[model samples]
Target: MIRTLLALNGALIRGALAFVLTTQEDIEVVAEVERAEDIGTALRTQRPDVAVADVNLFGAGVLSAGGASSGPPPVLVLVDPRRPKVLGDALRARCQRLGFLGSDVAPERVVEAVRRLAHGGSVVDADLVVAALNRDNPLTAREVEVLEIAAEGWPVVEIASKLSLSSGTVRNHLCRIAGKTGARTRIEAVRIARERGWI
Candidate 1:
């Protein structure tokens, strides 16, 4: 049997997905968790054959891009097409056998992805593939840093102090970010960056 673990926030979705998976003769859910930060520990303890996660929120994330450990176990993230930026979090995870499936993926497909992953194969959602191939990242790396800090509502002086830039320079970066993203305001720029998964 393929031991599976779940790390999704939506209770209803998690329950329904669990029910579907339980019906599959070869798959067994070993555990379920709500926090992305808890995924690594859960994996270490449970050591399931495959992990099926939901990352539609796109938060701080489950793994760092290749840091400190031998590597994390295989993780298959479920994403929503309407909010595809969560794919950014998945890419940042840097797990070896990562996979992406649409939130609305059919049960058969979910089973297939899990089985494929359990057997050391990779899976990718079509939308995630497109996002990976087409990113141009209009903002510079520092600009992305500024925008991410700004997204948390940091003021100009605070942002400048944190980055060791003058307040005027911080404002300049915001202005350029707005122009590049075609956003009329700072908040709109942040939203655009999030939609494009740049920050």
Candidate 2:
């Protein structure tokens, strides 16, 4: 059987996934963890063949992309296609052999993806693969850095001081960010950046 551990954030999805995979003849849902903090412990203890998770479970600074002990088992991260479109690459660059599926992917697809991963293979949703290829961050490095800081709800002057720039320059950056993201306001630009995983 393909030993599997679940680190999904949503309880309902976790329960449903357990039910779905348990019924499969070749897969076993070895463990399920709700809190992100518990994932490391669970992985170390359970040592599952595959760890199904959400992108947030693979948080920045928490996961290593390399195949080190600090990293997770070969992961099948379920990403929300509606948000931050290139999460697959974001995860893959950090870890080899990462599997990706859209959050709303069918049950059969989920099973197939898991089976694929267990055998030292990988899977990415076709739509997400295409989207990742076509999707490019339009913001320059400076602009993206500015927007990332802006996501913290900093004021224009504070952001300027933090980034060592003038208040007018910060305002111009915000305006440019807003225009590029088709956002009417700085808040909207931040939201868009967040959703697109740019920040």
Candidate 3:
């Protein structure tokens, strides 16, 4: 049996995880924690084979400085499907095991993900993979810089002033970016580009 540690921000998500694991004959939830501060203690006490952590726990920061310890169990992150590539890149950069799940995934899929991860396998939902790939259109350095600022809900006029470009030029660049990414709006283009590591 794969003894698992459940670390999630929401009580509902935690309860759902526990219910799913209980249904699996070869999986057991050995411990539960809600914060990064509690992770070490839980790992030490639970001695679990795998830890399933929600991406919300990490926020915008990279993994904690001493996040990975020799005695700590392997971690598999559950992340939003729309931002899988961004989360995947962060996990990969840390040399950590990861699994991506849409917020709406069923309990059976979560159990299967946990099982696969416990066995040293990586899992990313199929739809998320397609979305990541589809968002991979390359953007120029200048275009990406502009898009990053624009993504913060900035106006074209403001973006032009900040980047020392004419408003028309900013609009033109945004149009090109949207076309390349098959996005109808600048916000969608920026989100897709950022998620795919293009910006």
Candidate 4:
């Protein structure tokens, strides 16, 4: 049997997921949580083999495991099709499984994603995957590092010092990043870079 934990911010969505999972003979909904804060505890106590998380739960820092104990359960993030960037970044940063589903996805797709994740396979919707790849702007390794430091509110001089690069070199990187992302300023560039998983 596939034991699973469900963590969703919406009550209606939670109900839908529970209803769908219960229909699968091989799947068991061991626990349900309304907030990301409860995810760690639920994972530990329930010991579910798979965790279904909402992409919006990113605000709770659940993906970062901020409040969770060590060795949390493997996670499968369910993303809204309109916001693929947020989910993709979480997947890249944390190495978690991802499955995209809009608020209007049929119950069958949700069930399929759950089953795939329980068996250790990622399940991204075809359209969502295409959108993510097409929307993504490639960034070089140095550009990403510079953007990460800049996003932390470090001044250009400070960032340059930390990275052992000249201020001019850092500024050049920022300009190139801004041009590539169509951003008007360093702050905007950083924001775009982060949204695109460049940092």
Candidate 5:
């Protein structure tokens, strides 16, 4: 049997998925959690073979690129195409035993993904993978830092102060960011980067 842990947010959806998985004689729901914060502990205690969770749960600082070296089990993240940013989040997690499927896929498809992952295979949406491979982030690390601060409504001087850089240097970074993002204004640059999950 494949022991699976469900880490989605809604009780209704979680319960429904649990019911569906329970009907499968070869699968079992070992645990269910609503928040990403609970995933680590659940994984430790339950020691499930596979973990299926929402893509949004893999946000910044929540799951770093190399976090799941051997401590956590394989994870199948449900992605929503409408929120492309979450797709980037999942990619950033870089969990070796990871799988991705559209959130709206039928429950049976999720079952199939779980089985595939349990057996040392991967599951991913071909279109999503293609898009991700084609459109890569071009901004450098320092520029991303400046853009992230600017996104918070900070002024050039304050941003420079925060980063310990001069105002001219900050302005230069913003200019380069705008150019790289193909935006005419800093706000537009931030919006574009944010939409693409670059920062």
Candidate 6:
């Protein structure tokens, strides 16, 4: 039997996952956790063979430099295709045992992914794999820094103050960022950057 732990966020998602996975004769939902903070404790305590987690909750940090004997169990991370940055984070993690599936995938796909991870195999959705390949962050280091602040709703003057740059310089950077990203507004630039996993 495959022992699995779930660390998805929503109660409905959690309940549905448990019901679906439990119906599999070879799979058992040993633990379910709603908050990101509970994953570590559940992992250590339950010692499940596989874990299914939300990308937002598990983060790339879950794939730290440790094997199953020293770290968390192999994880199958469900990602939102619209949020390429989350997928980028998981790709950069580079864990051999980790798997990826689109959040909107059919329940059978989830079951397949979980089984793949349980067998120490890697799985990634075809669309996500393509996105990972095409996702090139076009912004330079400084531009990304500026856009990050802008994305947080900071004003130009405050951003300049925080970055220790003149107001005019910050404005220039913003203008260039817009040009580079082909964005009409600061908010749009940030959104574009986030969608492409640039910032």
Off by over 4 Å in 5: 56-71, 80-95, 136-143, 163-192
| Candidate 5 local lDDT, 1-199, one digit each (tens) | 9989898979999899999998999999999888877877777677788888887664322233222446567788888654466676677665677889878889999999999999999899876676555556899999999999999999999999999999999999999998898999888998888767686
Under the 3 Å rule for N, CA and C atoms, how many clashes does model 3 have?
Answer: 0
> What is the TM-score of each predicted model, taking all chains together?
0.73, 0.83, 0.66, 0.60, 0.67, 0.83
Per-residue lDDT tens digits for candidate 4, residues 99-197, read 555545787877887788767777766776776776655778898888889888999999999999999999999888888889998889876665554
Model 4 residue 31 lDDT? 89
Best-performing candidate as measured by TM-score: 6
Candidate 3 structure quality by residue, lDDT tens digits, 165-189: 9999999999888888889988788
Name the weakest run of 10 consecutive residues (lDDT summed) in model 3: 59-68
Q: How do the residues 43-150 of candidate 2 rate in per-residue lDDT, one tens digit apiece?
A: 667768888888777643225322235455678888887674557556545567688888888888989999998898879787777666666788889899898888
Error of 3 at 142 (Å): 3.0
Q: Which residue pairs come into collision in candidate 2?
A: 65-94, 65-95
Give the residue spans of candidate 3 off by over 4 A: 33-41, 44-47, 56-69, 96-106, 119-134, 178-199
Best by lDDT: 6
Q: Write the per-residue lDDT of candidate 1 for residues 34-136, one digit (tens) a residue.
A: 8777776676777777777777432333453221144555678887655555676567754557889877778789889999988889899886668666766
Which residue pairs overlap in candidate 5's backbone? none
Q: Write the per-residue lDDT of candidate 6 for residues 1-199, one digit (tens) a residue.
A: 9989888989999899899999999999988988776776777667788889899888533554232475667889898887767787777775567788988899999998888888878888988878777777778888888899999999999999989999999999999999988999999998888877788
Ranking by TM-score: 6, 2, 1, 5, 3, 4
Report the CA-based lDDT of candidate 5 relative to the real structure: 0.81
Residue 29, model 6: lDDT of 91
Candidate 4 segments whose C-alpha is farther than 4 A from its true place: 58-70, 96-103, 136-199
